[model samples]
Target: MKTTRVAIVIPEGLSGRGGIVRVTAYLTRHIQAHIPDIETHVYRSRYSDNALLKHLTAPFALAAFAVKCATGRIDVAHLNVAPRGSTLRKRLYQAVAKALGLRTVLHLHGSGYDQYYADLPAGRQAGVRAFFARADAVVALGDHWKRFMLTDLRLAPARVVEIPNGVPAALPIARAPNATPAIAFLGEVGHRKGVDVLIDALARLKAEGLAFTATIGGNGDLETARAQAARAGVMDRIVFLGWVDEAGADKVLRAADLLVLPSRAENQPVAILEAMARGLPVVATRIGGIPQQVLDGETGLLVEPDDAAQLAQALAALILSPERRAAYGQAGLRRFEAHFSVTACAERFAELYRSL
Candidate 1:
């Protein structure tokens, strides 16, 4: 069998910190591992931090990507699309691929895409429609996004593929006995992420005379989250580690007893998978592809978004019961190995590429 030559275009850098970046990096690594016969190349475009420049240069970047795809010895081109203000670039890239007669895949990476499409201007909406119509396939990270593309966006069901994000192997660490119950929140510290909600839950746990320390990793509006913790009188107990790379973040996950994500909205979160792979139980909000990854009451606990009391109850239960925590953690690790491992994800993609 001839090897498939694949070109991956990631305008955003490939540092593996954010969700999209992590997915692209992991997918590329997996492809290289499972399909060693497949030739893979990555093209990263430098995006300016300025919003205006980022918007204006999108078409040019796509055109450049098109030129590279047309000239290079590539069989398939995969573009990672995000709904966060990059719709124009995604459309342009898709159009260029269609014009050049190259098979293309648009791998979407965000949640709430129906709302995002409705908010687009009429002209931009038309462009987006044309782009999706012309692409060979549109890959959604989970069922929620696959449904959004089929029912809401009205894309053909045959063109959309549901591929859940997977977790990379965790670094080796000496397992710590269930001694101190440390809770952790990993992600942006913004309002949408519900950092304030987590702080409130911690306060409620304290009010009920529960003792636990929560460590927060990743950065976003830190001072505000700090103020919320201070107001709740749990400031001293909450440790803010700020932004960390993949390796450093994994270390934090390994040390925690439970991982908490109170996000108001989310796509498949890489942090949650990382936690599961590290044998830590998760307490996350019921939103987006999170439900697909975390089986409620089995591997982890799920609470409604922004519900402080429910979150507090869930956290307290795990903290007070070492046996329950260990059970959940072990279950989570098993789930990770069975379904969310990097090897399995890569094998699936290899099959998809062959089908294409």
Candidate 2:
């Protein structure tokens, strides 16, 4: 049998920096690994040299993607779709792919998609519905999202597929000695990520005479978070390391006793998977796909979103009990090997693509 040719269309300028870019990169790589005969090409809204043109000619980007799809060389065209305003071009490209007889997959990322869809203007909502209606398949990152698509959006149950995000193979990191019983927060630093909540929790811990260090990595709304940390009087114990790439993040993960994510909303965050793979216990809010990944008592602890006291208590417990922390870390590592491995996730995705 002739191998299928898959063309992945992504927004311009990601450059494998964002989570979506990482996911798309890994998905394409995995498809190539498993299906050797399957050729893969990535079509970005803008190329490296003319990246600025992607923004300048926003209206023409979809037309360009459509022209690529209509060349009769693509057996399947996969587009990463988010519910942001900039996704208008993707919406248009979906229609063009349908007209061109190219099988289309709309892979959704982000936990705020529900609000995004609900807030869309009526005309835009109609356009979104028409776009999804034309898709051959819709890939959701977690069961929570899959359920929302079926129950809330009323998308056909048969059309939605749930594929959880996977972590790449673990990188070696030398463990730090007596690492200050540190609590690490990785990823963008912003209100949406609940960095404020983490700061508040640290303040409460300080007030209660609890001693622990916090290492925050990544950049976004950093000034605001820094101001909040100062106001909370916990700035002394908090260290901000701006944005660290994948390898650097792994080193940070290995150095910490626990990982914290206090996001107001999330879809199976890659940070959690990477932390677990590195044998770090997690402390995160129970929202979106997080609950699915972090079993409350098994892999790590889960606190209510934006609850500083609960978040503080969870961190305190892990800090005081080295035995419990080790147990949770072990359990998390086992879970990663069992379910979140890249090879397993890629094989499953390849099967889905072949079925099409």
Candidate 3:
């Protein structure tokens, strides 16, 4: 097992704080611990999420990859790629890995990937196919993304597999029930995440005589979102904890009875899994792979994207009824433990590697 070397190529991953970075870090960490057959190395290809930083680090990243693979040490190259710049940066790694005859797995993780492919020019569209064609296998986050890779990309169906994202269990916390129940929102705050709609929904709940603390965490459009909250006269009930660290976020995830994610687009967010691991019920929009992770009505309720009225109605129901919240929360915990834990995800990858 120690002799089997694998390289995991991730862009802006080594020090980045984005969801993809966390995914790569978590899986790789567990793989090394759980599987004794493979020694894995993380080839940090773009340094930062910033465009200029990505450009600056490309040449160095390429050089590093070329040197590492030239030794013919890596038996498998597991590539974590998204769309646009992420795809462009990682192409060289896949190309070099293929040329070296290493087994390549292109793991896809982007909500807008389908649109990114469709919007590409004819020449670039062909490039996308050619890029993916180099891989020995393609890993999709869920069934929807897997269908796209096989049908849209025209890749062989046998070469694609769906491996949804997973998260580790939350740290032990002796949480005292909040007198006024807490409602939390994680990830970037912007039009894409329906943060504006969430603000409006708060106003809707206010009219219905519902009161709870709304903790909005993460970056992007805070100013615009703040103005929206102000206009809705719900600023008093909202708390903006800008860019929460892992520990800080875990606290919110554990304490909040209902975790809300009103995203317009998604591909099975790890944040939702984190909430589930904490036995926290979620109220996320029914978009993309979200339905696969969050079972509406069973685990937690799901609402249409950008519909403040429905989102408000769903949140208000959970807020008012403690019994319903506990039922949903416990059901969600069962789903998480059965399917989406880090150990389960690590074993899946280990089996995939063994097959290769």
Q: Measured by TM-score, how close is model 3 to the native structure?
A: 0.94
- Residue-wise C-alpha lDDT for candidate 1, range 138-161, written one tens digit per residue: 888888888878876679888888
Candidate 2 positional error at 162, Å: 1.2
lDDT of each: 0.80, 0.81, 0.84
What is the alpha-carbon lDDT of model 1 when measured against the actual structure? 0.80
Candidate 2 root-mean-square deviation in Å: 2.6
Better of 2 and 3 by TM-score: 3
As for candidate 3, its clashing pairs are none
Q: Candidate 2 lDDT, tens digit per residue, 1-356?
A: 77777777777534635577766677677767776866778877544424566567666666677777778888787778776744676776677777888888888876688888888888877777777767888888878999878876678988898888887768654544254688899988987799989999999989999778999998788899889989999899999999887778877887788899998988788899888988888999999889888989998999999899999999899888878888898899889888888787777666666778
The lowest-lDDT stretch of 10 consecutive residues in candidate 1 is 42-51
lDDT of 3 at 101: 82
Q: What TM-score would every model get versus the actual structure?
A: 0.92, 0.91, 0.94
TM-score quality measure for candidate 2 = 0.91
Ranking under lDDT, best-scoring first?
3, 2, 1
lDDT (Cα, 0-100) at 246 in candidate 3: 73
Q: Compare candidates 1 and 2 on TM-score and give the better one.
A: 1
